[model samples]
Target: MPNLPKKVRSKKLSSRVDLTAMVSVSFLLIIFFMVVGELSKGKAMALSLPEKYENGWHHWGCGSGSNERTITVLLDENNKIITYTGFLFNPRKAPKEINYGQNGIRKELFNQKKAILEYSTALGKPKNGPIVIIKPSKKSNFKNLVDILDEMAIINIETYAIVNEFTTEESQLLASK
Candidate 1:
């Protein structure tokens, strides 16, 4: 027998890869991000401050010369609330002491608002609703400020300002109290 070639053999290789752990890990990461995103949402109250005009006056009242159109609220220690209508130098009316409650500041604010609207209507002029000026004394606490602000929100006050300085008459009133 002549020399003959033996049967040739070919080797086969596996093409499959084990990716079960990778798929599971990717799904877990997606779920973690979704939960974290949902948990990060928060609620906050918005505060809008009055802007200063070119005439060196605040948009709320600082120097608008409209005493009858402004109401000042002074927050003092012991949760005292003192309110005055108009300018400190020549107040349109005497300051009144009020407390923090629905029947206290809230009632007074509503009454004042109604009076202003009625007066403006009688004069046949555009509605000049009163603006609230909130001043917190040094002894007043943060809770007092928050309480007054809440009162403002409840009454639907469209314009208001929080001033830090105290006028001479305001100091006198506080001293008298």
Candidate 2:
């Protein structure tokens, strides 16, 4: 070959990559994460707690009967509601006794109202359709129990029942007669 520079002959080779596909993939991932983050922030649990019945069986005046909207509030060992089940009337038979506590009672009651409101809105009706029922554990503190009742009164959820898990059978039998 003629006088060609050795340096020129030793030039390094390089390859080019198209970034369009990578950019598109990154954008899609970002959108997916954003949507997932928003959805995850939604309420994870929804429930309306019921009121306790001293006599074990109480009547809900609204012709709801078995079809009535039901809400179950669970009081843990500390007398606080661990969780709640709403929109279900006539929960499984009651237990012997229930306990109620005060700390989270207000929050639980508010949660019930919120659930009822949402449910009513979804059904294109008002919040008054649903009846709230409360069940406290037997070991619950009296003060807390009364406080929950007072809160319900404040909200005007008058149609309610206090049921013990074990007494449900007896109450049903009495109603049949």
Candidate 3:
């Protein structure tokens, strides 16, 4: 009877998988990477601070002749900009309030720069633009500082500084205005 080979059947196997755990792990990893990236992001502005020397501060406007060619810009709260020329104790004129636009700080810078150039030429010295000193108060925000820096580039200013501290007179001037 052919070794009695009859009515033999094979067992079938199911082909199904559960992907819920894998999907959950993938979502958790995505969220973790996103949070880490956000935490690593930085918001800071680049400022070139002047070097210190043993014999007082060695920087622009150190000589007596260049004193008259300095322009100081004070950035207070509420987008207020106060500009003046020469020393804080003896300003060339009262600190004037100006805005930020084509008819504001830009125009003031151009006019002051022209005046300084003319003065330098008149004194038989090489024509040089004014040395701008930007002083941002603690209450001032970053946007105003950036705007002033942009103005510097747009006006083609050759020399400038970002001073962090303010003199007593400068503080008083800001308070008065």
Candidate 4:
């Protein structure tokens, strides 16, 4: 019988998975999400606050029937805006819901501003712009507030304020319409 040489067996080598690509991809995803979250953040609006006090807080003008130089806008749901020249108790212009746009609130503001300027001129007083009071209701969204602020800016109104507190009458008024 011929002698046969036995074949030598080679040792098995273990295969390792490289996680470099996965790690890189994960880092990139994290960074992308972080950037997206930052971008999705709400942008803030700039506000200019008045001094401590003013001489014409409630009193708009000196002459009678000429004090309709101010208007209060109550923002409600679905872009509903309730506007009045004075308080709901004794409104100079009355409480009525107006639309939102150049033809709606903008035109009203323009006419009111024009009337105020004319009144001041007739009274031989300075042409101070009309005042606007913005009251955002509970049901009103941020967009509505922003739109009103934009209108105020578009009208070039100098005196305007965002009031958080709402009176009972205002609440009822907003609920009615």
For candidate 2, what is the lDDT?
0.52
Note each model's CA RMSD in angstroms.
6.4, 15.3, 7.2, 7.8
| lDDT (tens digit, per residue) of candidate 3 on 75-177 | 9999999998876556775689999899999999999888888888888876566888899999899999999999999999978988877777778878988
* TM-score list, all predictions: 0.65, 0.40, 0.65, 0.63
Worst 10 residues of 3 by lDDT: 50-59
TM-score-superior candidate, 1 or 4 = 1
lDDT of 4 by residue, 1-177 (tens): 788888989988879888999999999999999999999999987764323223223434444543466688889888899888854567788888899998999999889888887876776776656778788877899999999889888889888888766777778888888
Task: Give the Å shift of residue 98 in candidate 3.
Answer: 1.0
lDDT of 3: 0.83
Task: Write down the worst ten-residue block by lDDT for model 2.
Answer: 87-96
Candidate 3 error regions (>4 Å)? 1-64
Off by over 4 Å in 2: 1-69, 87-103, 127-129, 166-177
How much is the lDDT of residue 13 in candidate 4?
Answer: 81
Candidates arranged by lDDT, highest first:
3, 1, 4, 2
Give per-residue CA lDDT, model 2, range 56-167, as digits (tens): 4343433433232455544434544433333223443232233343435555556556766676667667645446555566665676567667867866665565555634
Candidate 4 stretches with Cα past 4 Å from truth are 1-66
- Measured by TM-score, how close is model 3 to the native structure? 0.65
Angstrom error of the Cα, residue 166, model 4: value is 1.3
Greater-lDDT candidate between 1 and 3: 3
Error of 3 at 103 (Å): 0.8
